[model samples]
Target: MGQIYDLAIIGGGVNGCGIARDAVGRGNSVFLCEMNDLASGTSSWSTKLIHGGLRYLEYYDFKLVRHALLEREVLWQIAPHIIRPLRFVLPHHAGLRPAWLLRLGLFLYDYIGGRKLLPPTRTLDLTRDETGKPLAPGRFKRGFEYSDCSVDDARLVVLTARDAADRGADIRTRTRATEIRQADGMWQVTVQDTATGDRSTISARTLVNAGGPWVENVLAVGAGVNAKAKVRLVQGSHIVVPKLYNHDRAYIFQNADGRIVFAIPYQDDFTLIGTTDIDYDGDPADVKISTDEINYLCKSVSEYLARPVLAEDVVWTYSGVRPLYDDGANEAKAATRDYVFELDLPGGLPLLSIYGGKITTYRRLAEEALQKLAPYLKGTKAKEGWTADAALPGGDFDVSAVDALIAELLRDYPFLTPAHANRLAHAYGTRAAKMLGTAKSPADLGQAFGATLTEREVRYLMANEWAVRAEDIVWRRSKLGLRLSKDEIAVLDQWLQANRAQPANPMREAGARS
Candidate 1:
């Protein structure tokens, strides 16, 4: 028998990566496999907020709201580079919930989660506040401003996985778990390399199915486990348009259908408006934004914005199927955002399948998962809760130190343009220095692949992060896809293909598994 790992996790989303990071810190041997690149699934397609579900308050899900709300600061502290406070402007609609009720909801939101660091909610005068300047004349008079956080959702997942890999967890991307079976009191997991068509088998004492939308399918097809728990697939879609507002604050508009849409300042050039909850019945991987969903988002935002956003204004659109735990909710919007775990330890071998969770509370979910699996794995020194205060990779500095870091980079790398320097500092934090090395000019950074993307940065992503394809770098690792032309992208693709056969560094090769 080969070396049996303490845990084998099957997913590369936030939950899986979070669990791997937590479990590995506890001194447990962990092996994680993803069918595609990290954060390529629902993880990358989030509304990109580390927030308490404000709308969930209507359903009286105070526990979930509080839990998620508490995580906002915790996550911000740990990954300050990628997670930052975002004040949301909730404009009151006379046709919908009353202002007093909104005030009461904001009150509960402020105090329920041991609020600290973030500012308290306050009433806003739309006519006077700069936040309302983008709104139509006399359309909204009063609003409520509350605090949440914006996150680089994809970077969060990748950084978590990087942390786990750094701590000796075997992290494999583009590897699919094909079959799982119990053999002699251990889990025999068969994984296939999607790129090479190579197969390998590994044994583990425990298994975790953290496949977001594919959680049910992982249990039924991958592990052949008959699960009693059901997952409701809800499709949420978003569209990106030219910047709708000049201010930094995000807007949350209340719609007639009892749903709310958010218009957030995205990447300095665009505003991200999203999310319609509709029942999804197809493959999660094939999910795409529909015309109706796009129209709904445009119409939703048009109600408040000074200028209407037409379909022609949209630059990009994405959709993801949320695998919510089916709670018999009448509508997709009503589905619980809380996570549920179903542990099946048939014949003394454990298989923990996870269902339904939002990104904000992923760390808590991971801690809970380890606690449940602790009883089954004896003699394993798994630490209880340490992730709350731990900084993710390249995020060891204070949130206020980002500007200092940027200034230092600008001084050190004089050849870098201000925009390029700022982008690097924000994307990689202190690690940007390592990528820059002793380069005195842009030419030293190798060929430029449009925008500020250089060969040096591309090589860093491939060598350290599990970035194998052009889409992986352009789309998930960075949103440079929005800026790069098709021709530039084709050049990037060609470069990646040409460099595919090269051997990776020792550090990266150590964590990667076939």
Candidate 2:
């Protein structure tokens, strides 16, 4: 007898949140539930690029490449604070594909996507260009530079969910959809609160299973629906090390194995090198970087860099299992990155399940999802193509104005250091002032949890951002975990536990599971 929503999405990854935002913007009643925190799955563990998948051209996936290539500027324009253009340096390897092929790929990449805002590709002289300063001498003589955009992947998901909430969509974190059944032409879903062990049932006209790697399990176990489509769980791992180069440009090194590896500037002090693709059959939640993956990453990047990266140089490592649609590709790296939707409308009730998508195409996927469900959703005044022009929360300003915003914040809060102010502007954009709240001194902001993470910011995250655990604030919300000591993290965790009931704003609860 609970409220019957127009759509009940069972996941909090980027795709689910994106769909919720688009659906709610169109004036549909939406309810989204996540068993864990937002972006805690493969969403956060991306290579963090809004790119056209230049490597995918070998497989002749021209449609997928063109679609993602076009989204690069679109995402950058909307979320300028978190998404910005990043030039990638592709060093020519003599043993790999010919330079002409690389040039052709870049040429296709430049023109296929209707690229306008980003600069076109150009050949680089490794002997003279600054981009080659950190490369091994005589190993790489020529390179190609192309455009893509880097993203704060976790923040993208959080902001999308926040925008949905602002538009009247209910977003519940730490709530798992335990069961789903069709009853009287509607879906009866049973969801459980992971924290409090409370259970509730809600009804919805349509259901969405955006469970990422758990998409198949959700269909078989949660909904009791047999899925005709299968998901191939491929594990990709990455490693973070001390800064490999002083410049901001990232590197794309082609390996002899026909796969590519990226060495991207990360967190101001580290370089992110990654991604080994291997078939994964274990539980997705338990995926972790293996010794072989680390060794492979180190060796792969060491081949091109001036200094060799060893296991001792690794600062951190993380892994995620990608739920790619099984196309029977012999190699895991060859699996299609395009999204597939399986809509089952048995007895006239809709259950849509998603599989195999990359971060760059999540917006397009969401738009397509809504279009598919539009037939089942009656009487809802929903529209399409609204998200293309809509800016995410706190991202209303132009991308070029971030520096000016930082300067304004400095003038207002003279007590903030330059680094702290810059960090805040990048993370929260215009909403940084909300966390500052007339504070004039460091003490006014509250207890420092290392690396400019103040109690004020923590409380702001809890109240406005649906953050509860220390890891949520330290790892996902921000990468302050790399700087905070274990003792500092423990203190913050203890304080959070002690102040659970005393949120900064009591009225704005962190998505109560009604």
Candidate 3:
């Protein structure tokens, strides 16, 4: 066996990354491999809301809703820059879910999570409150206001990976584990780097499969066996358009079929509406937003909005398949978003697999997975769980202090514009100082890579963050690609050609072993 690892995790989604962060913090040497850019899968395709799942109350999923609602605050305190409180408006309808049921659900939502910093849910007068200004007369009479949190899903995954690496875990993005086998009481794994087509091998005491929608695929194709082949795949899609209205509050409108739709303020200039449930059977990577889904979502929004949401209004759209633990639910909409863990000690080498988890409960899911697989470690010792209070990378400061922190940063470097300072604060939080360094003026920053990206940030991403491809910088590390010109992207491509790392003649990396 090669150098022993306490855990080797496949798939760099939120669940895998969170487990890496948690396991490494517990003194377990870890190796995490991802086939594509980190969080490039379903982990990044969520509606980007971290709520207590108020709608889940209808199905008696009170436990999940309460946990999610509670995590809304916990994660906000840890990563205030990327996560913040947002108000949602539930317009009272003449027919759908009676006011009494909605009221009781709100009451339980507030009390179930042990209500804290967030404001309590309250009755709204659609005609009086500023939140109801853009409504059509006679359409909206009353509503309710409740609190939830929005997140940059990609960054959350990256921060988890960053924290795990800082804790001494080795992260291998753009690398795919081709095969795993148990030999002589140890697990042998072969990995191929997708970029350069380089292959190598490694060995670990335990293997973890957290491949999100590809969980079953990994077990069948990579592990070469159908282990726990009792999972279901359900597709959910979202669409983006120019911000529909100027209100800061979101609207949740129930459709004719008892399903709900959300119209949210996105990127300060766009509105994000989504999520239609459809049964999926194809490869997850190949899933795309269908025209029917687009029409369905738009019609749902049209039912409540003063302005109808037409297909032309959609600027961007995406789709993701949720790997649900099949509970034999007939309807995709009624399926559970909760997770399950399957631990098998084949050849005395433990393999822990994960399935069906939402963003809100990833941390707790990681803790539980660790405990479930703890006994498999045998005589080898590992740290106990303690990630609850720990601050993730750049999340040490509370949200209340963000303004003060930004003010101090700007005071030190007056040359930086407010946009630059805010962007840095948003990406790096207090740790923006490390990226800013001693640059006194804009010229001190390296080449302009478009959007708000500076050369300095590029170098920082290459050195600290596991940024490899140009797409990694444009899409994941930063959303600058959405705002940059074509010429600017060309410049980034040129810069990447010059800075590509030279691998050894052996044609293998240190972490590649079978």
lDDT of 1: 0.90
Instruction: Judging by TM-score, tell me the better candidate of 2 and 3.
Output: 2
| 177-238 per-residue lDDT for model 2 (tens digits) | 88888887788888899999999988999999999998877776557578989999999999
**Model 1 residue 177 lDDT score:** 89
Error of 1 at 85 (Å): 1.0
Question: How many residue pairs clash in all the candidates, one count each?
Answer: 0, 0, 9
What shift in Å separates residue 297 of candidate 2 from its native position after superposition? 0.4
TM-score of every model versus the real structure:
0.97, 0.97, 0.94
Worst 10 residues of 2 by lDDT: 505-514
Estimate the Cα RMSD of every predicted model relative to the unseen true structure: 2.3, 2.3, 4.2
Q: List the residue pairs that clash in candidate 2.
A: none
Worst 10 residues of 3 by lDDT: 505-514
Q: Report how far residue 230 has shifted in candidate 3, in Å.
A: 2.3
Error of 3 at 452 (Å): 1.4
TM-score of 3: 0.94
